[model samples]
Each structure stands twice: as C-alpha cells, then as structure tokens.
Target chain A: MFHLLDIIGTIAFAMSGALTAMNKKLDLFGVFIIAFVTAVGGGTLRDVMIGRTPVGWMLDLEYVYVICFAFVLTLVFRKKFEKLRTSLFLFDTIGLGVFTLIGLEKGISVGLHPTICIALGTMTACFGGVIRDILCAEIPVIFRKEIYATICILGGIVFFLLKSFHLDNDILYLITSLVIISVRLMAVKFKWYLPTLEKN
Target chain B: MFHLLDIIGTIAFAMSGALTAMNKKLDLFGVFIIAFVTAVGGGTLRDVMIGRTPVGWMLDLEYVYVICFAFVLTLVFRKKFEKLRTSLFLFDTIGLGVFTLIGLEKGISVGLHPTICIALGTMTACFGGVIRDILCAEIPVIFRKEIYATICILGGIVFFLLKSFHLDNDILYLITSLVIISVRLMAVKFKWYLPTLEKN
Candidate 1:
C-alpha cells in the first residue's frame, strides 16, 4: 500500500516537472532531467542525509521507469494538461502527504530528534518542487507563496503526538498522511498563502 | 596538508557566497545561509550521494566556525571587497582544485568507477556555485559561462592517468591539483568561456 502511494506521488511530481520544463522552453533532455529530479530529488536528499546508500531511486529502477512513463504522458497530453490541472493537483497533494510520511518514518527509524524528523518530513514533501523551481531559475514557490511545507510540519507533529499514545503503526501512518492531504486540500480551497517577505 | 587546503577552500567559498547574497540585497540571515550553503553545499551533496553519514561539517564544527568567520570578514570588508577581488578569485580557484581532489579521493576510497569519480570531483568543486546561482534566481553560471567544471574533469582524468603509472600518492595529488589550478588560472586569464546555448 505504501509502495503504491509512493509510485503515485512520483508520477505526479514527474509530470509536473515535465510541464514546468516545457513551459520554460527547455530541450527534451532538460525536460526529462527536471522530471526525474522533481520525482525523486527529495527522497534522494533524505536518503543521502540519513546515510542510505545507492539512494532510493538508484536502488529501485521502478522509479526510473515510472518517471519515463510520466515524461511521455506529459508530452503527449500537453494540450489537455490544462483540463487535467485539477486532477494533477489532487495527485500532487497525495504525493505531498505520502512523501512527508516516508520522510518522517525514515527519520524516526534513524532515531533523529523530533524537530529533525519534522524537518525531514517537510523536505521530503516540498524540496522536489523547491529544486524544480530553482532549476527553472525562480525562488522556490514554497518559501514564498504557499502553505505547503507548513502542512507537512503539522502532519509530522501530529504523527509524533499520536505515537506518544502508542497508536498502531498502520493507523499512525494513515492518519498522518490523511491529515496532511486534507490540510493541503483545505489550504488550496481557501486560497491560503504565506505573506510575501518584503525587502527591508 | 589536505585538511588545511579544505579549510582555505571553505573560507573562500563562504565569503564568495556572502558577497553574492549581499549584492542581491538579502537580509543578514539570508546572507549567512547563502554563505553556509556556498561553502558546504557541494561537499554535503557529494557526501550524501556517496552515503557518507553525518556529513563532514556535522562531524566537525571547524567548517561552521570558519564560515562564520568568513561571513563577518565579508560584511566588515564589504567596502574593500572590490580591492580583494583578485585574491578572492585566486582562493576560489584553489578551492576548486583542492575540492576536486578531495572528491576524487573519496570516490576512489568507495571503489567507484573512474567516470563516476570524475563526476563526483566536478560536483564537489562546482555544485556549491550552482546551488548559489539557483537560489539567486539565475541559471548556474558554470553551466553556461565558464571552463570551470571542465578543468575539474580534466584534473580527474589526469589523476587517474598518473595512477596508472604507479605514482606516489603525495606527488599524484599535487600534480593533479596543480593541473586544475593552473588550467583555471589560464582559462580566466584568456577569458575562455563556453558558447551560450540558445532557446531552440
């Protein structure tokens, strides 16, 4: 079940990355590279920091295959992507939720501090987009525009809070991910955003 | 010693990052973060990819101290930074050479392929600047403007070529770094740059 969610998230992220690269007028190679990075960059970073060798994607060729499939899908349906935006957004939110939980679980398994765990969670869920924006030569949208990472951090907190009660592992994971996904949905529906930082 | 060169490289990279951030009109905190990233970002990325846990700076606080020192020095001497440009450039070039060597050695220790080791070397010596540029909302200057990474790649090849001759470790490292440094110096002196790619 977790693996299924992960694959869904990777596909969403990869398509979004491809779309962004196309919007930027990048070459085909550049588009594919961006797609791959957005799909796995966060988990790769997390794995590296936690000393997980060969990285998650490198160890599993499944990710590469999925990303390639996503790339082709995006390119083929570029014109219809506008209509698919809502669906894409839904998948992206799912990705955000699942990736955050994965990061939190990895950090907990490594016995990292709770604060560090939360940070890892946020990074896993958001840094792919952060890297995507950066490669497209823009400040990361998360740092300025959205309530995205805040949801992951909150979800992480809730996970730990529930863990204190010795909740079932499966229940804990489900609840945390649901919390993140719902909050993200609400945030978007309500048009919630962070205040832009002004030059002082 | 390698350690001493690494420190010098860290200080130079940190100050350069600080200087760039200040030029972008970032607040003090922003400047410090950029400095920290510029000094250690490449090595952190390299370490993470190679599964080096805790990372170099996390294990030793010396990197943090030197970066702080560099931050202060850059801010205080901001007015005179123009005068120090040549010296700073020299230091940055030295960093490029030394960092490439460190990365190459680490790859060899890990028993990676020669090609992968060269890539690791280039990443160690160049990715900090790439990340800095990305954060600053510009395409990485190295990707377009300079012969910087090419030198590191060449240096890596040279290192391996000399290794095939059974050269002593000290002499091998010295020659390889010298090759990188001198080539970079000449590249700059000759104003050598890669041709820019146009949007197709």
Candidate 2:
C-alpha cells in the first residue's frame, strides 16, 4: 500500500514540476530535470542528510522512468490537465502525507530525537517543492504564507502522539497520513494561511 | 595553509550570502540562515554525495561561529562595506578557487572518475551562490552567461593535467587555484559570457 502511494505521489510531483517548466518555457532537457528533481529531491535530501549514498532515485531507475512518463503526459495533455486542478491537489496532498511518514520512519530508524524526526518529516514532505521553486527562481510557497509545511509538522506531532499509545504500525501510518491530507485540504478549501510580515 | 584558506573562504562565502540577504531585506534570522547555507552548502552537498556522514559543518562548530561573526560584521558595517566591492570580489574569487580544490580532493579520496571529480569541484565552488540566489528568488548567475563555474571546471582540468607531470601536491594545489582565480578575474575584466538562448 505504501509503495503504491509513493508511486502515485511521485507521478503527481513530476507532473507538477513538468507543468511548471512548461509555463516557464524551459527546454525539453530542463523540463525532465525539473520533473525528476521535484519527484525525488526531498527524499534524496533526507537520505543524503542521514548518510545514505547513491540516493534513492540513483538506486532505482524506476523513478527516472516515472518522471519521464509524467513529463510526456503533461506535454501531451497540457490543456486537459489544466482543468484537473482539484485532482492534482488531491494527489499532491497524498504525496505530502506519504513523504512525511517515510521521513519520520527514517529518522526513527536512525534514532534521532523526536523533535528532529519531526523536522526531517517536514523537510521530506516539503523540500521537493522547495527545490522546484528554487530551480524556477521563485521563493518557495511554503517559505511564504502557505500552510503546507505547517500541516506536515502537525501530522508529525500526531504520529508521535499516537506512537505513545502503542498502536499497530500500519494503523499509525494510516492515521497520520489522513491527518495530513485532511489538514491540507481543509486549509486550501478555507483559504487558511499564515500571516506574512509587512515589508518594513 | 589549506586550513587557513578554508577558513577565509568560509568567511567570504558567508559575507557574500549575508550581503545578498540584506539586499532582499531579510530579517536577522534569515540573514544568518542564508549566510550559513552559503558558507557550507556547497561542501555539505559534496560530502553528502560522497557518503560523508553528518557533513563537515555538523562535525565542526567553528563554521557556525565564523558565519555568525561574518553576519555580525555585515550587519554592523553595511554602508562602509558598500565601498568594498573590489575586496568582496577578490574574496569571492579566492573562495571559489579553494572550494574547487577541496571538492576535487574529496572526490579523488572517494575514487571517483576524474571527470566526475571535476564536476564535483565546480559544484562545490558555485553551488553556494546558486543556493543564495535561489533563496533570494533569482536565477543563479552561473546558470546564465556568467563565467563562474566554467573557471572551476577549467581549474580542475588543469589540476589533473599538472598531476600527470607528478607535481608536488602543494604545488598542484597552488597552480590549480591560480588558474581559477586568474580565469575569473580575466573573464570579469573582459566581459566574457556564454551565449544565452534567444527568447523563443
């Protein structure tokens, strides 16, 4: 189930990146590069931080194939996909939840402090988009008023809180993912945002 | 001697990042974050790629202290430093040279191919500025027509070519660094640029 969710998330992230590249009028190589980075950059960062070499995407060629498929899909159906904003949002939210859980688990495996684990989870869920925005020469939406990373952090907190109750691992994962997805959807639906500081 | 140069390079990179942050009107915390990332982000990336755990900055707290000192220096003497553009450019160039050598050596230590080592060296010398530019919501100067990264690559090639002559390690280092700094200075003086793609 986790593996399936991960694949779905990867495709979604890749499509989002490809669409952004298209909007920026990037070359074909640039589009593929951006798509691949957006799909795997967060996990790659997490792995690198904790001393994992060759990174996840480097180990598995499937990620490359998936990103390529996503890029082609975006290129061929740009207009059709334009009307799928809600679906894209849904996939992105699911991706965020799954990524957070993966990061949190990796941190636990490494025996990092819980607070640090929460940070890792947030980074895993958000840094892909951060890298994507950076590559596109834009301030990351999460770094601004977006409620994205905040929701990941909250979900991480919930993960640990439930861990204290000794629930089954699969149950814990399900609950945490649900919390993240629900929070993200509600935030977008209600137009919730963190307040930005006024320019001085 | 390499240690001293490394410290100097760190300080220069930190100052460069701090200046960029100030230009963007970032808060004090943002200033420090940007400064720290610019000082160590390149090397940290290289280390991560080569499977070095915990990264250099994490192992040595001195980098943090230095970045903080640089940030304070920038914060206090903003106006005075405005007239020091020449000094800043010199420091930046020297930093680039030293960082390239350090990355090249690290890559060699890991037994990577010479070409990959050269790429790593270039990344080390330039990625800090790339990160800083991205954080500031601008395209990295190196990604455009700037002759920055090209100089590092050239220096790396020189390092290997000179190594074939069995030069002493220190001599090799000196020659490589000189090549990088000279190329950068000459490029800037000559207004050298790679041709950018025309807007489609």
Candidate 3:
C-alpha cells in the first residue's frame, strides 16, 4: 500500500518537474534531469546525510522507469496535463505526505532524535521540489512562505504523537498521511501563507 | 600541503556563499546555511554518488570551524573582502583545483570509470557554487556557458594523461592544480565562454 503511494508521489513529482522544464525551454537532457531530481533529490539528500549510500533510485531502477514514463507522458499531453492542475496538486500533496512518512520512518530506524527526525521528514518531503525550483532558477516555494514545509513538519509531529498511543502501524501511517494531505489542501483553499521578509 | 589548499578552498567557497546570501538579504541562519552548502555541497554530492556516507564534514568538525571562521571573516570585513575580489578569485580557483583533485582521487579510489571520474571532479569543484546560486535564486554560472566546469573536465583529462608517464604524486597534484587554476584565470581574463544555446 505504502509502495503504491510512493510510486504515485514519484510520478506526480516527475510530471511537475517535466512540465517546469518544458516551460523553461530546457532541452531533452535537461527535462529528464530536472524530472529525476525533483522526484528523488530530497530523499537522496536524506539518505546521504544519514549514511545510506547508493541511494534509493540507484538501488531501484523502477524509479528511473517511472520518471521516464512521466517525462514522456507530460511531453505528449502537455495541454491536457496543464488543464488538470487540480488533480496534479492533489497527487503532489499525497506524494508529500507519503514522502514525509518514509523520511520519518528512516530517521526512527536510524535512532535519531525526535526533533532531528521531524527535520529529516521535512527535508525528504520538500527538498525534491526545492531542488526542482533551484534547477529551474527560481526560489523554492517552501522558502517563499508557501506553508509547504510547515505542513510536513506538522505532519511529522502528528506522526510521533500518535505513535505514543501505540496505534497499529498501518493506522498510524494512514492518519499521518491524511493529516498532511488535508493540511496542504486547506492551506491552498484558504490561500494561507507565512509572512515574507520585507525587502531591505 | 594539500590539506592547506583544501582549507583555503573551503574558506574561499564559504566567503563566496556568505556574500551571495548577504546580497540576497538572507537572515543569519540562511547565511550560514548557504555558506556551509557552498563550501561542502560539491564534495558532499561527490561523496554520496560514490557511496561514501556520513560525508567528510559529518566525520570531521574542522570543516565546520573553517567555514564558521570564513563566515565571520566575511561578515565583519565585508568591505575589505569586497576590495580583495582578485585575491578571493585566486583562492576560489585554487579551491576549485584542489577540490577537483580530491574528487578525482576519490572516484579513482572507488574504481569508477575514467569518464565518470572526470565528471565527478567537475561536479565536486562546481556544484557547491551551483547550490549557492540556486539557493540565492540565480542561475548557476556553470550551467550558463561559463568556462568553469569545462576547465575542471579538461584538468581531469590532463591529470590522467600525465599519470600515464607515472610522475611523483606531489608533483602530479601540483601540476594538475596549477593547470586548472591557470586555465580558469585565463578564461576569465580572455572573456572565453562556451557557446550558449539560442533561445527558441
């Protein structure tokens, strides 16, 4: 079940990356690179920081295939995909939730502190988009007061708090992911944002 | 001698990152984050690619101290440092040279392909600045047809060509680093650049 969610998230992120690359007029190589990075860059960073080498995508060629499929899909139906922005946003949010859980689980398995785990979760969920924006030569939405990383952080806190109740692992995962996706959707619906710093 | 060069390069990169962060009007935390990323980001990426985990800085605190020292130096004497742009550029070039060597050596030690090693060297020397630029919401100089990563790739090729003659290790290091530094300086002085893609 979690694996399915992971695949969905990866595809969503990859499509988003591919679309961004096309908008930037990047060549084929740049498009694929951006898509791959946007899908896995965050997890790669987390793995590297925690001493998990050869990373996930390196170990599993499935991600490569998925991202390539996403790239081609986006390229073929750019207009149709653009029109489905709402659906894409939903998938991206789901991806964010699952990614946060994966990161938090990895951190716990490694015996890191709770605070550090929350940070790792946030990094895992958001850094991929951060990397995509950076590669596209734009400020990351998370850093721009979009309330993205904040949602991941809050979801992480919820994960640990629920864990204290000794709930079933599946139940815990479901609840945490739901919270993240709901919060993200609400943030968008309400046009909620953190305050930006004033220009000096 | 190589250690000294590494320190010089780290400081140079840190200063460059800190300065960019300041220009972006990032707060102190953001400044430090950018400075640290700029100093170690390339090496960290290289290390992660080759399955070296916990990375170099995570293993040793010396880099942290050096980067911190660099940040404080840049912060306190911003004007003086700005006036020393030429000197700073020289240090940065030297840093690039040594960083390239370090990356190349690491790749070779891990028995990676020669082409991959050269690519790793270029990435190790340049990606920190790339990360800094991306974080600062600017296009990376390396990606912009600047004669930067090109020099590192050429230097890597030179290093291996010289190795065919079996020179002394210290001499090889010095010659390779000098070649890289000279090429970069000349590229800047001569306004040399790779041809950029024509906008569609």
Candidate 4:
C-alpha cells in the first residue's frame, strides 16, 4: 500500500517536472533529465545527507524506468496538454504532501529526532523543486516567502503527534497527507505568502 | 595561513565560473550567483555531508566578500580575462589542488576513514565545477572521460599516507597540491582522456 502511494507520487512528480521543461521549450533530452532530477533529486540529497548507501534510485532501478516513462508520456501529450501550468502545479502539490509524509515516517523509523525528521520531510518534498528552479536559472520560489515547505513541516509534526497518541498507521498517514495537501492548495488559492526577510 | 589560501582559491574558482557565465552571456546577477556557487558549492557539500554545522561561508563572512570582490574584478577585466584561457586554466588547476588538499585535511580532522577522505576530497575539489557546467547547460567535462576527479582522489590518498607518517603539515599540503596540480596539467597538455563508451 505504501509502495503504491510512492509510485503514484513519483509519477506525479516526474510529470510536473516534464511539464515545466515543456513550458520552457527545452529539448527532449533536457525534459527527460529535468524530470528525472525532480523526481529523485530530493530523496538522493536526503539519503546522501543521512549516509544511506547506494541512494534511493540506485537501490531501485524501477525509479529510472518510471521517470523515463513519464518523460515519454509528457512528450507524446505535449500538444494536447498545452495548458500545462495549472495541471502540473496540481500534480506537484499532491506529490509534495505525500512525499513529506513518507520522508517523516522514514526518518522517524530510522530513529532520528523529531526536529530532524521535520527537516527531512521538508527537504524531501521541496529540494527537488529547488534544484529544478536553480537549473532553469530562476530564484527558488519554494524558499523565498513561499508557504510550501512550511506546510510540509506542519504536516510532519502532526504525524508524529498523532502517532504518539497510538493512532492507526493508515489513519496517521492519511491525515498527514490531507493536512499538507489542503494547506498548500488553500494557500495557492488565496495567494498566501510568508513574510520575506523578516525585520529585526 | 589557511584562511589566506582559501581566499586565493575562492578568487580563482569564482573567476573561472564567472568567465564561463560571461561566455554564455548571462546577466550581471546571473554571473554573480554562478560565480558564488562555483566558489563555495563543493566545500559546502562536503561540510554538509560530514554533518558540520554553521557551513564554512556562514562561519566566515569573508568568503562571501571574496566572491563579491571576484565579481567586480571579473567585470572590470572581462575582455582581458576572456583572451587568457590558458592562464585561467592554470589558476583553476591550482585552485583544484588547494581545494583537494583542504578537503582531505578536513576529512581527516573529522576522523573519516581514508577511503572516504579521498572521496570527500575529489567531491570538494571538482563537484562545484560539475555543478557550474550543468547550470550553464553544458555536459560536465569532468565526468566526460577525464582524469580530473580521479587525480584528486589519488592525491588525497598520498596526503593521508604522508600524514600517517607524521609528516609536517605544511610539507604534506605542499606535496599533495603539487602532485594533483602536476598530474592535471600534464593530462590537459598531453590531451589525455578516458575511453568513451562504445556506441551500440
């Protein structure tokens, strides 16, 4: 069940990345590479930081296949999906929530502190997008006055707190995911933003 | 002192990165950011992987100043520097050697195993350039059939063996840097390259 959600999240993330490349009018190889990076970059970073051997993608070749498939599918549908911005953002938002939950769950299971787990969750959900934006030569929207990573951290904390109360594992994951997705979507809809460069 | 050498290395690295960005005709802000990232990205990655808090740049504001200074200098001498690829490559090579030695020294100071120390050294000295090239939308030459990273690792091992023999710190740094720089320069002069993968 968990694996199913993970694959769904991976496909969604890859599609979002590929859509961004399409929007930018990059070549086919460029689109594939960006999509692959967006889908795997965050987990690779998290694993590397934690000293996890082989990295997540190296351990599972299926991830490469998934990213390739996503890239091809996006290319095939490029004309039909001309209005890709809204749909891509929606997919990316879904991925953000689910990936945050999974990252927090993995970190806690590995015996990390709660603060670190929250950080891990935020990184897992956001770093890939950060890298994507950086490579596309743009300032990272996620870090500068965006409510994106903050939503992930809040959702991660909720998971730990609920789990500590002996909640069902499935219930914990669902509620965590729901909270994040709802908060992020609502923020986008309302054009919400965090204060940037807070005054002392 | 090490701080002085670090500043020199930063200037060289930033100038190299800025030159590449200028070749690509990027804006002033883009050039500055690329130069800054090329200067500090590798060392920052090494420190983060080793779980070091307060990354080197955050510890000393001078690194930031160094990059800013480098940007202004590059802006002044853009045309002159552009016509001096040979000299720029020499400065870049020396910076690589210095960075490799510093990375190995930091790794040993932090008690990493010798093999991992070598890995960290190569990462610190070369990863920044790889990232810089990627951001410029070029395939990283270091990864494309080159002796770059491999040379850094070899010199790092030499550094470790000498340190283990209770060699003087200054002498060890000198010898290691010489070994790395000499081999890299020779490789370039002789047109040395690794064999490419056979096409299907």
The residue-by-residue lDDT of candidate 3 on A1-200, one tens digit each, is 89999999999999989888988999999999999999999998899787886788899999999999988988888889758999899989989999999999988987776766876898898899888988887866566556788888899999999999999999999999999999999999999876432223
Query: DockQ numbers for every candidate?
Result: 0.19, 0.18, 0.17, 0.06
| Candidate 1 ranges with C-alpha deviation above 4 Å | B1-43, B49-51, B56-130, B139-200
Q: Report the error of model 1 at residue B165, Å.
A: 29
Report i-RMS for every model.
Answer: 5.2, 4.8, 4.6, 10.1
What is the Cα-based lDDT of residue B26 in candidate 1? 61
TM-score of each: 0.61, 0.62, 0.62, 0.58
* Model 4 lDDT per residue over A60-145, tens place: 66887888787777767766664666776776777888889867866887899999999999999988888777655667778786
CA-RMSD of model 3: 6.8
lDDT of 3 by residue, B67-168 (tens): 989988887787676479899999999999999999999999999988999999999999999988879887787898678999999999999999889999
Backbone clash total, candidate 1: 0
True contacts kept of each: 0.32, 0.30, 0.27, 0.03
In what order do the candidates fall by TM-score, top score first? 2, 3, 1, 4
- Give the per-residue lDDT of model 4 (tens digit) for B1-200: 66666678789999988988988999999899889989998998778766675678899898899999999999999878648778778878888888998788777777766766776788788878868887898655564546677778789878878888998888999889899989999998898765432111
* Segments of candidate 3 deviating more than 4 angstroms: A1-44, A48-122, A125-129, A132-137, A141-200, B197-200
Clash list (residue pairs), candidate 2: none
Full-model lDDT for every candidate = 0.87, 0.85, 0.87, 0.79
Clash list (residue pairs), candidate 1: none
